[model samples]
Target: MTTFQKVNRYKKIIQDYINKHPEKNSDDVLKHLLLRHIPLNKDSEQSLQALSKFRTTINPFFRELVKTLKNPEKNIIEVLDIYLKANPIKKNDDFFALLVAYFNSFEDLYTNKDLQNNTALYQQVIVPLHLYRERMEKDKVDLACELLERRPVLKYEDRDLNAINFMSPDYRRISSEYYENQRIKDSVRKDHRLACEMIRTMAIPKKELGRVITDLLKKIDSDDSLVYLIFETLGSLPIPKDQQSIVVTKLLEKVQNSKNRSDSEAAVKALIKIPIPKQQGEQVAGILLENIYSGTYDFRSLVPKLASIEGQLERVVTHAIETASKSKPSSRIFDNSPEYTTHRLACESLKILAGLPILTESLRERAVDVFLILAGYSDQQMYRPALEAFREMTIPESRHEKVVNKLLENVDSKDGIYCSYSCQALAVPTVFEGYHEKIINKLMEKIRDPNGKNIIYFCVALASMPLLEHQHDEVSNRLFELVDTKNSDDFGYTVQQAFRALLKMADSNEEYEKVAAKILEKLDSGDYRVKCSVCNVLRGAVLPERFHVRVVTKLLELIDGKDYTVMNNVCETLGKFPIPTSLVEQVVSKLLPCVDITSGHHSIDKCACEALGNISIPEHQHEVVFNKLYDRIDTFKGSFPQSVKPDACEAIGKINFNALQCPVIFYKLFMRVMNPDNVFETLNRDNMILNTLSALYNKMTPTERINIVARLESMQDDVASKQPNRLPFLLSVIQKCQSINAFSAGLLSHLPAEKAEDVRSGMVR
Candidate 1:
């Protein structure tokens, strides 16, 4: 027979089977055809080709199959089992899309056992599902909406069924009128109401949302629970502009007059969320100002909202200055005194006011006046916030003279702590530039005094101040002299700060080498404690690249030292330095043995792992380095603690493996991290690996990234069931598959509503 005739015959046979079993969908019919008809026809290839040619005839069947998967009459696992048996039918993109849609239909709230008892079926589908992740990611919104319309809640077992929640006073009335009529109880109606609300909110169209917003607002005066839920719902929806005022009015009433503090807090929170018009920003600011001293609103939340408008911010600062003026400065703070309360409030208010981006000259002067008054009060706790505020002020160069005078006077305070705090505040470059000489002269005078105190703060403040090329030598020579005066226990910190001060002066390659040589000289001549302090300084330093080898060479010698604190400090400091090409062998050789389980030092081992990660290993060294690190991962050896494994995984992941090596490295990481026996450890280790993979992802070639993603996708089940909290992190890494943010926005915009709500809560929680 001709090929056309044969194709026609096969179509007829499949049609007869579908006609006979009217209940069977495309997947079922395909299975029947494969199991029963293909053998009788004895032309598997011909039948398969005919099916592909007449695929359009079966297009409706595929759509019907997706619908069935959405609200399956039978167990979804059993349903998919039949689908998986028909491998030929699974070849098309539609089947893969249907699989992804079906999987996402289940909520993250479902327990692993509730999801799929049939591991075989899940494994079969996950492979192809992952293969089509890119395609589904593009259509994620449409797919979620489609699935929601048919089967709003996907995984609902009898275990989830519970009596209607009558805990809320409104529950019985609402359930009797709404849920009772709909008969949603056989499903997880009571238990998953939030899930229902989330899906309902997501599925609602923009045009329809106005009415929902209005209805939710009308009920804001109900019980506090319902009021919070309504306000939360309002925050998520884009309320109409006309209704925005209604929202603000309702929330304002709650803020000023709600019986419960939580309700007032919630109202203030909701007000912060709704965008106020630029023209009306001052009006909102005025309303908030009216309630500022009412002891009802959270000023911290109100600050950002008011700060959005320049006029509002100025008004806020003006009000803050007025409030500060009400409290008289006293010799000491008292808990019960009204003056103390007012002063405390003023101090807190000034700190918040100081953080604003813009402060008018008059407001700055008044605010500084309040700060100076607060400084004289004997409360040490109150001084730093006020002084820090003084430091943070955005004073133009023309206006800094008075501020410089006040700070300098404080620097000369006989109260040592107060002097140190003032010195700490002078570290701002903008304020310190022209006034460095006056401050330097005062600090030098204090340092030279026999009774001087807080020398460490003086050294730190001097180091942090931006210095010109001509000032470097003078400061370095003074710090070096201080380092030479360090035999006494009281001068140890002074000596360390001196070393830090000298290193901070090195901005040029020659200067850096000079500093490095001086540090080595100290390391060689200094005691164990001095060596430890030097290592600590280098750990936080920006690190000098030109003289990295000399520093690295010195650090390597200290790595194997008997002092635990010094060894760990040395390893951490070494991690901060990029390995110079000439010393890669020397550095790696010295550090590798430190990570060995036999090293007997836990902290040092972890730091060694970090040090290994910080360097760039050549391609030729990838195997030895990867193998050594991989052996430290838990799955390879039981003795390695969870603490060490994550760092080891991090160490291995940071290496730039060749394409041929990417899959192997990822596979090892996946196996090590997917341990179902211990979910907590799995999550922590997975987080470490995924973070490293994400950082390494962009550096890899397109082909290498694709391979890595495919390998990661293959373990989707292990991720979904084993360590689900890490799902967001995994998706984030996978999202790098698409470069543009618009595509990411779509993914977020479609994230199973409740998931999106959780993400929002996580931000503030």
Candidate 2:
């Protein structure tokens, strides 16, 4: 078949499937798009290239695709790898348009250990990330709006990505209704009613939603289901920071008196997103706790709602303690499903308060009781958070002496994480408080407890120990022993820490060499902690410059280490040492690979990449790292983590000017970051990007020199109105503009006064 024929054939097949099952198509298109590279054909190539056409064609499916991508085709995700290899851009968000949404769809929220090393997932995640560069060229809004309107036909989930979302009939009805009900629709009350309809129609699950769109429209005008929709769509709306609390107050009043369970539940869930302005949140929490505890209302129905206060942390804490005191404490506190979530809510509330404030004596005491009781929790889901909260609260303080001692006394009786929990908590300041000897002696007493909690306990304890607090102690001696095994995760962490402390206090060769050997023994440890400790010990050691070679070797072991932060971290530590050639090569190679990593292709991996840049030696690694970094910086489409990209950009500019004497790379990387697409998407405010621009301009091309005047002029409005993060980048651009014009005359024998002042009005420097 001809290329167009094949494309048309696939498009028809996809559209046919979408016609049969519309809802399923949303996820399919997203899954298809996130491929490491999208394969655009003769048919869809133009559509991908024309972003406005793509968005309009895809808009109807936007909501559905979001839902599908959210749930994902976990089993069929490998399919994305196939598409990514094709390098197709079906959509664009900002400058880097085309299937960028698909790239995002493939990302898991935090690091996904389950599929971390999976090569197929890697292909699905990175290639399009690389492909995004082509679509990110400079463009005007008219073109953007035009891209949003285009219809590109593509196969996703055996269906046409566009066909499934082509509910023209719904749009017609909505448009007609919009015109007929324009006044009402424009009104706030009707706006609320419309939100209710959207929730009942678009947001709520079909089974739970019960009524159809027409019925929902009538009901939402009077129902509470709209509350959930409002909160869910909160991100899309232009909500003022101050107006949130007031709206929340209204929602609470509505939920408080609502007769419908659905209405009440929706209202409570909506409350989760509202920022409670601390004081207002506390007031609401107080009312909630009192109402639940005073026996005025059955706590059973309100637990989930109360749990929603997790967002308003302080209020949640105050209310939780008050509720516990007001009501009788027993295992049966949560009597039903809704109340069950309430107990979990209280647990969550306590979870947030840990390490925040131990001010409330009674609250801490009760919270400790809650954690202990929950240690045996039947639900593993709740147990994890509760356990985490327990560990957080038990940091090296004796604030809960009675609780810690009580927990420690019974540590041997417990098994699994329960015992681990107690031992780890007891290792804190509370146990060792001015009684270091007593705490050290007690460490071996609970070694028998399973779940390895005691092991974790020692790890944390050793890390938190004061550097000069213990001098040449036996505890340090025991750490030396554990450092030898280096295989156990927790044990390695503990030994590595002890090494960090000893290296600082070690005054003589005897002490330095003693810890160095222990550090070396674990140099082969695959665990990042071991490698890091090995790196740290070698950092300040008086080891001969010859040791710098081995130190570089040890740091290399962590270069591509699974832990994202390990490579950059090792380099950072190594940078501190006075070193030579081998060290320079090793550091350069380690940093270059990070520039290639596309984890920051999404919002998540940016931090790791940024850290890589921060530790980089911009002066030396210039040629080796600059070009590839410039490419990555120029190509990145969406908002990246603030830390990584900026550092990368700054390092690139610095190395370009100081190392390579290439000033042009500066203008290219600067413009790419300054003009990122999706102006409103949350990730764009990477302060690091701006910091890099500012640093670059400050050092080499300050505004007074006015080198890249046009770009600065273009971004002037954005610089003024850009999110808080872009402020620094703008400042640099402006500073450079002003400085260039103010000082541009210095670069030449003959300078024009008119040209100089005009430049001064345009930039910051």
Which lDDT values do the candidates have, in the order given? 0.60, 0.46
TM-score of 2: 0.47
lDDT of 2 at 193: 39
Off by over 4 Å in 1: 1-302, 309-311, 322-349, 396-399, 427-429, 432-441, 455-475, 487-492, 504-514, 540-546, 593-606, 620-653, 663-675, 678-690, 703-736, 739-765
lDDT of 2 by residue, 578-630 (tens): 55664565566665665555453332234334433444354555555666665
lDDT of 1 at 546: 66
Put down candidate 1 lDDT per residue, 150-268, tens digits, no spaces: 32242223221145566878565665555444455323232222322342324344444565565566556533445654565566666678777777778777766777777777777
TM-score per candidate, in order?
A: 0.60, 0.47
Highest lDDT scorer: 1
Report the lDDT of model 2 for residue 741.
Answer: 37
